[model samples]
Target: MASITGSSISSSFKLNQALNRVCCLKTPSISFKGISLSSSRLNQATRRLSITCAAKPETVNKVCDIVKKQLALSADTAVCGESKFAALGADSLDTVEIVMGLEEEFGISVEEDSAQNIATVQDAADLIEDLISKNA
Candidate 1:
């Protein structure tokens, strides 16, 4: 039993190495764990990686827009910089959706701790600005 287990582990390692080499070759696409990664997808990812630093006011306005849209608020709804999401009638799920909207809009991923710390629209704007700068 022990010999069989050891042989299986060694075979698995060799298979993984072979897969890595094949995936590393200049191919238009590669499949791993049932997910296909294409060159076009890689290009899109590279495009998304090109972050631009926007002015503070612009970031705030964009963040507000994302929040308003995520919450399905009226276009005329006032989203003040200091307004807390809770004040805007956002529940936990709403907050998560808002965070997702922000991520999609900015093309940047927010850490769990950082996302949890966002309470106000201004907080979200500030975090987004910071992320943009770091990504830039």
Candidate 2:
């Protein structure tokens, strides 16, 4: 299977890095895998931080980083569960914004209802990757 990998970094750091990677450039769907973070290194990362994504591990980490930065939350505040948005601390507006950002980043349209249905980062990533494959 195809996968993309990267080193683990702070959530904000990952966001800046991903945004920079796609700065002002139209691109295809990004296929990346999980980011490896040593437990020790994650300790160095912001506290209560949670990273999750529907894409590969690397993409998941990137998404987690961005979300962490936007929400000013720690990793503990984030998760990759299959529940509801309210259960995940995402208001309707936050969900919409996140959906829009993910669409731009991965080139997919996440239906509002669909966005509401996504409770975990992995769910979101899987949806994005599925859309990418369909577009491809």
Candidate 3:
């Protein structure tokens, strides 16, 4: 999508089609056939704007473990970074316990205000990393 402002019409058309596929089909696959990227400032700006900061795999795994344990989920249950606490049958007290477990495991303290903002495993992982880095 960063090359959306490319110099080729075919590229733009393909990007538009890919965007439609993502929006309509709810798929992560995007095809960039015949896309010619131009070395333009606008394209560079678009690239910067689209950049995302994802959680580290180890951090996500640890968070997943804590979340699964707190929720008492079985080994067969699939818990990923995207798994939300509420969706995993965790209430407010359960979320607090999960946060406590994360804090103890990571040796990082999470603020009450910050704890309230965590919903998904990725959120908890990101916060743990942030807190650990800040403390270090």
User: Which candidate ranks first by TM-score, i.e. highest?
Assistant: 3
Better of 1 and 2 by TM-score: 1
lDDT agreement with native, every candidate: 0.69, 0.54, 0.70
Minimum summed lDDT over a 10-residue window in model 1 is located at: 19-28
Candidate 3 Cα errors over 4 Å, as ranges: 1-53
Worst 10 residues of 2 by lDDT: 20-29
Candidate 2: residue 7 lDDT (0-100):
64
lDDT of 2: 0.54
- Taking all chains together, the TM-score of candidate 1 against the true structure is 0.58
Ranking by lDDT: 3, 1, 2
Instruction: Give residue 10's lDDT in candidate 1 (0 to 100).
Output: 71
* Residue-level lDDT tens digits of model 1 in 41-136: 744543443233233767878888888888998876667555678867799899999999999988999998999999978789888988989999
**lDDT against true structure, model 3:** 0.70
Give lDDT tens digits, candidate 2, residues 4-112: 4456455454444443333223332333445443434433332223233235666665566555555566655533322234444667787777777788777777777
My TM-score estimates for the predictions, one after another, are 0.58, 0.49, 0.62
Ranking by TM-score: 3, 1, 2
